[model samples]
Each structure stands twice: as C-alpha cells, then as structure tokens.
Target: MSRLTRRRALRTLAVPALAAALALPLLAPPAQAQAGRNVRLLVGFPAGGGSDVIARLLAEKLKDELGGANVIVENKPGAGGQLAAQALKSAPADGSTFFVTHDHTVSILPLVVKTPGFDTAHDFVPVAGFATFANAWAVSGGTPAKSMAEYVAWVKNAGGGKGAVGIPAPASVPEFLVRLVAEKYKLDLVAAPYRGSAPMMADMLGNQIGAGLGSVPDFIDNHRHGKLRVVAVMGDKRQAQLPDVPTLAELGLPGFEDLPFYGVFAPAGTPRPVTDAFSAALAKVVALPDVKERLTAMGLSVGHVPGAQFGAKERAYSAAWAKVIKASGFVPQ
Candidate 1:
C-alpha cells in the first residue's frame, strides 16, 4: 500500500473539489434573487390615493413572484412625500425595501422642499415604472365655468376678482399646471394648497374652491357624478376615460405637456442583480391583461418603462422640474 496508491486517491478527490467550486454559483439555491425574504413597498402617500393604488397592485403581484414572501405596502405620507423618501434612505439596501411614488415625490418635492431627506439621483435606484397619467383641470358643478374658455373668462372677469384654484399639493405638477394656465390666460388665478386630493375634491364639491387641478382619475368619477366638470387635460393627447376633454395643447396651451409618471425604486446600494430581478418581475406584472385592464379602468395608461430608461427619465424630470419650480418662485416649506 504505498506512496503511489495514496497520491492517486488524493488526485481523485481534488478533481471533484475543483468541479464543485466551479459550479458553486449555479447550485446556490438559485441565489434567492426573486425575493430575499420580506419585501416592503413603501408609498409616500395616503392609502386611497393614486400612488397607494399602484403600490398595492404591484405588491400583490410581487408577493406571488417572490416565493410566498410577504410584500407589504407601507404608507408614510407626509411632508409632501419626504417622510417616505427618508424611510427609504434608512432602510437596508438588501432588496427587501422599495419606494413607489410619482414624479412629484421623486422629482418635484426635492426641488421645492428644503433638505428633502434623500437625493433622487444619488440615494435611490430605479426598479421599474408602474403607470403614467396626466393632470386635469376641473371645476365644481356650482361653478359657471363649463369649459376651458369659460373657466378662463370667469377667472378673469368674475365677481370674486381673482378666482381661487385648489391644488392637491403646493409645488406639485398640478400646481405648476395651474400656474401656467393662469399666466397664459392672464387670469387672476389664486392657488390654494390642500393636504390631499380627497380634501381638495371635497372643497370643489362644496363650492369652497372655484376650480381644482389634480390627476384625471381624482376628478373623472366625480365629473361622471355631475359634481365636477373637467376643462382641460395636461397631456399631449386626450385621456381615454374623458375623451371629450381636450388637452392643453388643443386648448392652445402647449407648455403644460409634462406627463407625470409613477415608478418603483429601491434604496441606493441594492445589489444590481436584485434590482434587475425586481425590474423583470414588475415588467411581467404590468403586462398582465387583468392588471392592465384594472389600471386602464382607473384612467391610467399602462406604460411600463424598464429600469434604466426609468432612471434616466427620473433624472430628466428632476432637472426639468427644478427649472420650473425655480421659475415659479416656489419656496420650500
């Protein structure tokens, strides 16, 4: 039994060891890339708002794809979404936590709010876009303004002098659009900032505000209920839900063409592989017929942009909104 036999056995063992090492990644339980345990989709808005609706939709689909892992939708609505942005910054970047918010939370808030917790370009990574919608200008049924032309004329020559317009949040997309409209029409349009869309809708219904600017979905049902009248949409084209309502361009105001986008984002430093997996999952979910139909029914267009494209869009939006916010003379609260 000698040195030759012992050397032959050792060489035989080494061959299998090298092969196992080479195949380690392939055999590592599929890397748990789908969902690495508990995942939370954080929304920086109230439960009943449009952002929450999108988050809940994505959470339901993500839970199914993440191997039964719990996917929770946590609402941290405050400071115009800075609370949730800060929460995302503090969360572990192990792919378990994410932020789902619209362009206002990600792009406009930081520009208007002093020290808005996290930097959009530096502290967060885009996963995928959920949906995009345009803002609509609507008046309460009690208001005499039934169309854009009427609304502008009423604001300019009405007895109230400067007509007050209710906006969901100050420095948001709707607020900016309202300002642009006022400037365009030379109307004395005073902006009234409300906490959320619900309260603003209530004010509009109660006749406390002359008009309101917000997401189209916020007022579409009410408009159908005969409580409000949509004047113009801030989109390139008319929204399908309200086909009769012309866009701002059609109404001769083309500068208010910025469409708001909603997207999923992870805390910065999340692994690239994990982000990619999440993006792929989200793309699949948005593509589902039922999901698409549900979103369409809610007056949202089913436009799912990939991670890189979404990130670029977010950056561009930030830059564009920064200029708009600065020019509008909106100081941080």
Candidate 2:
C-alpha cells in the first residue's frame, strides 16, 4: 500500500483504541474492583485488650460495609499506643491505614508525654468517635478490699501505708488518678505501669498486683465473674453495667468527671471524602443491633459521631484534660 493509504488506516485503528481505553474505568464495579484491596485497622494495644477486641469486631463488619475491602486489624502495641500513632503518621493517607484507639492515646498522652512523636492535631485526621466509656478502680483477688474506702484502709494497713497500684500504661490518666488517690489518702502509693491492659489484667488476675485502674471494658468480664472487684468509677454518673459501683465524684475524688472516648483516626492529609466515607461506614456498623449490644456489654455507651464533629469533641476533651493535668502539677514526661 502507498504511504498515504497506510497512514489513513492507522488513524482509523487508533480512534477505536482510545475510545475503548476511555470506557474501561466505567466498566469496573467499585465493590468488586476492591475485592483484594487490603485496609489495615491498627490498634496500639496487645491482643485480647479492649482496643484490640473492638478493632477486630470493627474490622469484621467494616469488610462488608466498605465495599468488599479486606479489612484487617494490626496490633502495634508499645508505649501506650505511641508506636501505633507514629506508624499511622507515616502511613500513606490513601485510606489504607487507620488507628483505632481510646482517649488515652489521643487526649491523655499528648497532655502527659513530653514528646509523643505524633501530634494529634497535625499528624492525624479523625475518622469517627464510636463510643464513650468509664474507667474503674478495681481490686484483684489478692486484696481484701471491697470498696474504695476499704481499699484506702487496706493501703494504710498494708506495709505501713505503702502499696503499688497497677496502671495499664505510664504517663496516662490512670497514673494521674493513682497520684491523686495517693495524695487523698496520704499514702506512699506507687503506680505500676504495664505495656497494655491485657498484661496488667493478667497480673491482676494472678494476684501479682493488688489493684488496677483501667477502662470499664477492661474489667467488666472479670468483675462479672468474681475475678476482681470494681470499687470506684470515673465520670459523673455510675456506669449502667456496674450500677452498684459508686462514681469517683461521690467519693470525693471528683476530677475525672469527663468520660473517656473511643475513636478511629487516619493519617493526616487523608482526603476529606475518604474520611467521610469511613465515618459513614462506622456509623452504620455501630448502629447494628448486635454490634451495639456487644459494645454496651463491654461497658461502652455506643454512639457514632461523624468525622468533623468528632474532631471538635476530641479537641474539647483534650482541652479539659489539659486543665486537670495542670492542676495535678504533672510534668509532661
């Protein structure tokens, strides 16, 4: 064929090729296309802890809600979620990685740690706040104390007014509470810090530690089984799951009126639409009857707050803790 004829034939084939390429994206189904795509839900506590259990539950439900995305929970336990927060900071903000944590890592840590490595305001974007919960002061089988007063009395009698109280992590709200408890009772009480709630609970169950302060979810099962005794709880009101337990405010230890929160956050710079999608999916998941029932049984007041509104709540909660930390004269470590 002549050069002109060959050129004309090539142009005809190129037109069809370009049209087919343009139609490819439209032909793919959003859900099916994401079938093998992996989405990681990161928890900063060891397996069997409250945070880890919640993450696993969410991951199971989120797989279906997030358009067939293969959601998985990854535990990056250390430094009371410091390592996980740092990991989230370095993760790509393409909706692939998210941190599932409680107020301790986000609100309390920043107020207590000298340099937590990741800034909550600058390093992360709040995806959603799922629930709020109380923290409880519980006595292990090792102690004869049934209530806070008895616990105080027991501390006074034991070893000449010196005892150790176990806290899930160092420089956390429970540690601060331990200090306040010591001051209130005028005892030389030491706060023992553990990597996460699971190990702390292990020690408490084994009677290696006399007492501990942690989330209601952390102690609810054990308390119900008579493994431990929950004496005083934080927040303004008594927990529904443990109604017989008295609030700290009623016991004259009134600083922790604000309840702790549970939330999911993505790395900073994640697109708003991406976060919004996650928030919506989480809301739906939290609304499920079984999911809500499970969380409630675990000691959480299950509710879903959207991303932007949740972020505002987070800031307000952080600010409130800041005042309490200042009043306690806690130097950021």
Candidate 3:
C-alpha cells in the first residue's frame, strides 16, 4: 500500500477510537464516582434525636468502612422527614449522598400525605436496613400512672373524658395509635404533633403533656431514669431494652403487631455497585460488637438486612399500615 493510503486508514481508525472514548462515560455506569469523595449522610430530624443519633453512630464507623472516606451527617428536619426525602430526590445520584430514615418517611408518609412531593419507589433505592424498633407509650413524671391500665384510667378521668397526647409527627403511626387508644377507652384524646421526637420529649420532660407515643429509644433513657414511664409498647414481643414494658397486644391492643424499621437509601439511578458497596460496609458496621451493643441498648433489634430484603419489608409494612389508615378515616394533608 502507498504511504498516503496507510496514513488515511490510520486517521479513520483514530476517529472511531476517539468517539468511543468520549462515549464511554455516557454509556457505562459511574462505578468510581463514589470513591474519593465526601459522603453526605442526611438525617430528617434534629441533632440529639433518635434518627440523628443513629446516623452519627453509623457515620463514625461507615467512614472507616468506606476506606477512610468522610461521612458527614446533615440534618434536614421538617414535615416528618419529608424535606430530607425530597432532598434525596433532588440530589445527584452519584452515590455521594444517602438518607438514613425509618419507615415513616418512606412508607407511611406517602400513604398519609395527599402530595408528599416525592415517591419512595420512584425516587430512591434501599441501601440497607440495620434494625427494627418498637414504639412505646410513655407518661410524664407528673403522671401517677406507671402502667397501661392506670394510664387509661387517668386519661379517662382527665377533664371528664378529655385528654391530649404528643406525637413525634402528624399523620404518623403514633397518631394512629393515639386514635386507637381513644376509641378503645372512649376518651376524647387528641394527638398533638411536633416536628420530631426531641421537641415532644422536651414537652414531656416539662410535664406539659401527660403522655406520648414514640420509639422505645426515644423514651428508653427517660424511662430508665424515672423521668417518664413507658407503660406499653407496640410489637408482638417485648423489646429487649424494655423487657418489663408489656406489649400493646398484651394490653388488648392487638393491631400494631408490626414494628418499624431503620434503613438507608440512595437516590434512584445511583450505580448498583455503589449502593451494594455501601450496603456491604453498613453490614460490617452493624455487626461490630460495640455497634450491636449500643443499638440493642437503645431498643433496636439489630441485624443486617440487605437492600432487596429491606425494600420488601418496607412494602409489607406499608401495606399493613394502609389498612389501619383506611379504617381510621384519616384525611391526608
């Protein structure tokens, strides 16, 4: 072949090679995008709250698990975790951002909110679930009621069948339980919703509210110190941290056998490898002896549930609560 012809052929091959090189980024997943970058771990509650505490605890170890990548906890507290969920939706799905939240924002919020602004199934992918927790009904120190039966009697007599209870957020499972308690005992009990458990707990500690329903972790320390009393808990079995607290079923409140879960999620379209890597790291973190002990002490039944199984659990939990919400005739806001 002539030298000029050979040169032309090489030029032609180079054009396709250059085109393929440019297209590689667009066609393939950003598998390495999560590496060597700061990870933002978002929590939908204020600092010092249960979700925030859990996020910080996991963040500490997850940073090391990710080969020394920094994991920063960013709190976006409002609308019962709606803001954080929406933040995840708007964020870049490059695996640098993740939301750590529980069943409320993902499962129950969509069910109760007429327009939650983001759909969990459409906007997010489950990364992992670390534990399941039970919700407990607690009374303030001012209340003489130390047991479920006594608490019911106290509420029945308050203002001649009128009372108010605090909940971490509006349209939550705690609110549903409040409604159930009202119907069972025939009291005019109202649910007063707060931004998060922290504020509700503040009110409880100040004796502003006679009773509140929240996670066992939310009330465990207070219950232990006698600052408040946890009279009843939701779940089939007693929580390990509050073994003396009777199950709501044992108190004849049998509907809330299902427990809530805590899990992490990444924005939809994040590379599966990125999410899987985080999930695997989270599993190791959860299995750490100190992490397991701390979580159990905080009333969580700690276990490492993979992403797919976590997602399935979320769906089943949502379905179970749908019936309760429907029966209660709750108008979505």
Better of 1 and 2 by lDDT: 2
- Better candidate by lDDT, 1 or 3: 3
Per residue, candidate 1 scores C-alpha lDDT tens digits across 9-96 of 9999999999998655333331354435778889887777767777788789877766567889999877668799999999999778
lDDT of each: 0.81, 0.90, 0.90
From the highest lDDT down, the ranking of the candidates is: 2, 3, 1
Candidates 1 and 2 compared: the better one by TM-score is 2
Q: After superposition, how far is residue 324 of candidate 3 from its true place, in Å?
A: 1.1
Model 3 steric clash pairs = none
Residue-by-residue lDDT tens digits, candidate 2, 115-225: 889999999999999999998999998899999999888988885898888899998889989989898889898999999999999999999989999999999999999
Error of 2 at 116 (Å): 1.6
Candidate 1's displacement at residue 300, Å, is: 1.6
> All predictions: root-mean-square deviation over Cα?
4.1, 5.2, 3.6
- Reference-based lDDT, residue 83, model 3: 97
Which regions of candidate 1 fall more than 4 Å away from where they truly are?
1-36, 156-158, 331-333
TM-score of each: 0.87, 0.90, 0.91
In candidate 1, the residue pairs with backbone N, CA or C atoms under 3 Å apart (3 or more residues apart, or in different chains) clash, namely none
In model 2, the worst 10-residue window by lDDT is 25-34
